[model samples]
Target: METNEDKQAFEPKVVAFLCNWCSYAGADSAGISRLKSPANILPIRVMCSGRVSPEMILRAFRSGADGVMVLGCHIGDCHYIDANHRTVKRVTLLQNLLGYTGINPDRLVLDWVSSSEGPKFAKVTRKFVEKVRELGPMAEEMGKSLPASKINVLVEEVTG
Candidate 1:
């Protein structure tokens, strides 16, 4: 039988948005190179990191992601020419906004990675997974503020 302490070590569900031209390739490279990465992250590829809007991120949270990550080309390496700038700004703001709503800002991470940095991808994902696991589940944290009924209603509004 599993002890309560064992149950307390929750595995978080993470949603990651990766730039198609860079971060996504980096993640693929990590896999091809036989690097170990946490399976908790669910990746969604976009043409550029800038394409990941706050709404999409909020939806991920509303859909029950315990953490979110946005990985893009290193500063100037964006295939779309400086598009990652928007991602940088928006993600920063979203992190603060989520914090204001009682969610820990650390739940969101933004980083840069190149396609050739396979080992770096594995390292980053592992670190992020560990960080989120320590923070525990979003649903439990959210439950302290609002009732489940309210959360379901908000989710419906967002989804619609």
Candidate 2:
């Protein structure tokens, strides 16, 4: 018999890429403030979110992360001044591509958080964790496979 504690103890593994100028600082702020954020997230710091590549995201999924997140500075407020543009476009396209490849796009999330927004960091991480928990494990997704025809079609479309 599984108790409520047992049910609530299911912790999904999350890979988070945070920008050093903002999101990483926000994570530090959350830690400093002792905010209630989920422990599932494993953070990797980058100079900018713009540096998060599609390959990196795919690798996270391939490596068994139940969910992945990229957090960066807000548009126009980026320390690099517009570098976040690539982050936005890339993440959007990647989400769509994930769906096309028969993966749940919700497994990835992108957000903006300034260094001062510790509570927001805590809230967003908590929310993402809950969403992924509901989505279950990456094993469930890995168990399913995309049709070869679908892959071929996508490959042809891209190659053309």
Candidate 3:
């Protein structure tokens, strides 16, 4: 049986995808600078925001992340030259899809952050954490809007 404290102890889980060339470095800088950011974020460093696939984002949510963030180099300043452009397009489409499926699209966020922008990274992460906190547990929506069987069916329909 679950107790009130158990339910109250449910801290939202956040997954952050950070571009290695910028946002990842900025995260390291935040640690070095001892800047205080929310402790809920689980950072995953990727080579570029362009490397993030829709599958990864969906997996994060399916795996119980209350919110997700994708941080990359500023527009026109990607280390791979326009890599963030692909990221922008993909996330936008994903957001729309999430909305269509009755998911709160605000749970996902995309932002530009330079290596020098450690404070900005901290700020963005803090804000994201707060937003997710307000949304409560995403498990509350499972089997209601998006479920494994439903996602598999959607995938099959799209592919086949």
Candidate 4:
């Protein structure tokens, strides 16, 4: 018999899209500094947060990511000059879309972490992991896949 304790022990898989110039360096610094970030995070480095499109995020979730994080430089600090501005907008829209698709918007998060803020990176990642753990397994939440026709209608609603 599965107890509540067994369910509470679930560890969520998290995918983090880190900007190459800032968030990735911050994660590296966190490791070098021996800051304890959760092992659940699988980091993927991107040239800029703006480059992480909705399709990529959807793919991550479809591929079994329980949660996704897009971390970038602080506003006005992006190496690409204002690129993260687009990141902010895109993530907001994506979160709404995720909600519409029956996914909890909280499953997606966007935050800024500069290269020098190793401690912040560790703290942020730890908190996010804990939150996802509380949310339980993605497979449980997504028990039934939305039909293709429903997906098409949603796409049209969002795009049209």
Candidate 5:
């Protein structure tokens, strides 16, 4: 049996996809500025948040990420003009899809952080990590019916 202490000790794995021109720089700035953020976040830099497809987010979950975050420039501040607008739409749709698939939609997060907003980046990451920790592990939510192997098989069937 698991004790409350064991539950409290659970640290979730989080993958954060950050846009290169803004959120990524913000995260880096946070590090350079000595602003503390959660160590559980594995940051992946992309050209733009708009480029983060649903498949990539799903793949992160399939690869054992308990939670995923898509961070980009604030609205109207995107280097790619309105790219983050598309990000908003995609992430919202994906959240609904995740809920339908038995995964907690809260496991995925989408937010904005400009290159100069290092403090915001740190704050957002810390909060997200805490939320995921409270949600426990992804496997717990997925249960046995949707194990990694079964998910892969489903993906293959859909894609092929």
Candidate 6:
């Protein structure tokens, strides 16, 4: 049984991958507009969502992010003129891979938010944070599938 301490002490950490041209700017706009979004998310600004490689997402999970978000331009609105195409393809594949590996695909989210959509950005961030808080700690659930040997390697990789 979970203690009251567990419930009161829970603070989910999230990693947000934001496209520099749009979603990152949207996040900035949200801040400028004084929209309240959860402070749990740590945003990493990339040139494009297309640049978020599989290794990076997996590394985020392995490094103790309870949830991850990928935000970019709309399907037809990529600043790189189709850069988001690769993002769509890659994230779709990554979602499936996460599911197969026994991780909840819902722990990851993909959305499009233009720089003008500060409200949308704040809403999405708040929603994702709440969802992660409900889902509890991912690292604990993941331990069921991870072998001790693999964990040792992962620990060394992260800590060394």
Query: Could you tell me the lDDT of residue 42 within candidate 5?
Result: 96
Question: How well is each residue in 1-160 modelled by candidate 3, as lDDT tens digits?
Answer: 5567866777889999999999999998888889998999999999999999999999999899999999999998899998799999999999999989788999999999889888999999999998888777888755455447777988899999
The parts of candidate 5 lying over 4 Å away from their true place are 144-160
Clashes of each: 0, 0, 0, 0, 0, 0
Q: List where candidate 4 sits over 4 angstroms from the true fold.
A: 144-160
- What lDDT would each prediction earn against the true structure? 0.91, 0.93, 0.91, 0.93, 0.93, 0.92
Tell me the TM-score of model 4.
Answer: 0.87
Cα lDDT of model 1 by residue, 5-124, tens digit: 855778899999999999999999999999999999899999899999999998999999999999999998999899999999999999999888778999999999899999999999
Residue-level lDDT tens digits of model 4 in 68-116: 9999999999999998999999999999998997889999999999999
The order of the candidates by TM-score, greatest first, is: 5, 6, 4, 1, 2, 3
lDDT by residue for model 6 (1-160), tens: 7887896688999999999999999999999999998999999999999999989998999898999999999988898999899988899899999999789998999999999899999999999999998888997677656447777988899999
Which pairs of residues collide in candidate 5?
Answer: none
> How does candidate 4 score on lDDT?
0.93
In model 6, residue pairs whose N, Cα or C atoms come closer than 3 Å (at least 3 residues apart or on different chains), thus clashing, are none
Q: Candidate 1 local accuracy as lDDT?
A: 0.91
Q: What is the lDDT of candidate 2?
A: 0.93
What value does the lDDT take at residue 34 in candidate 5? 98
lDDT of 5 by residue, 1-160 (tens): 6689988889899999999999999998999999999999999999999999999999999999999999999999999999889999999999999889778999999999999899999999999999999889998777746447777988899999
Which portions of model 2 miss their true places by more than 4 Å?
Answer: 1-9, 145-160
Candidate with the larger TM-score of 1 and 6: 6
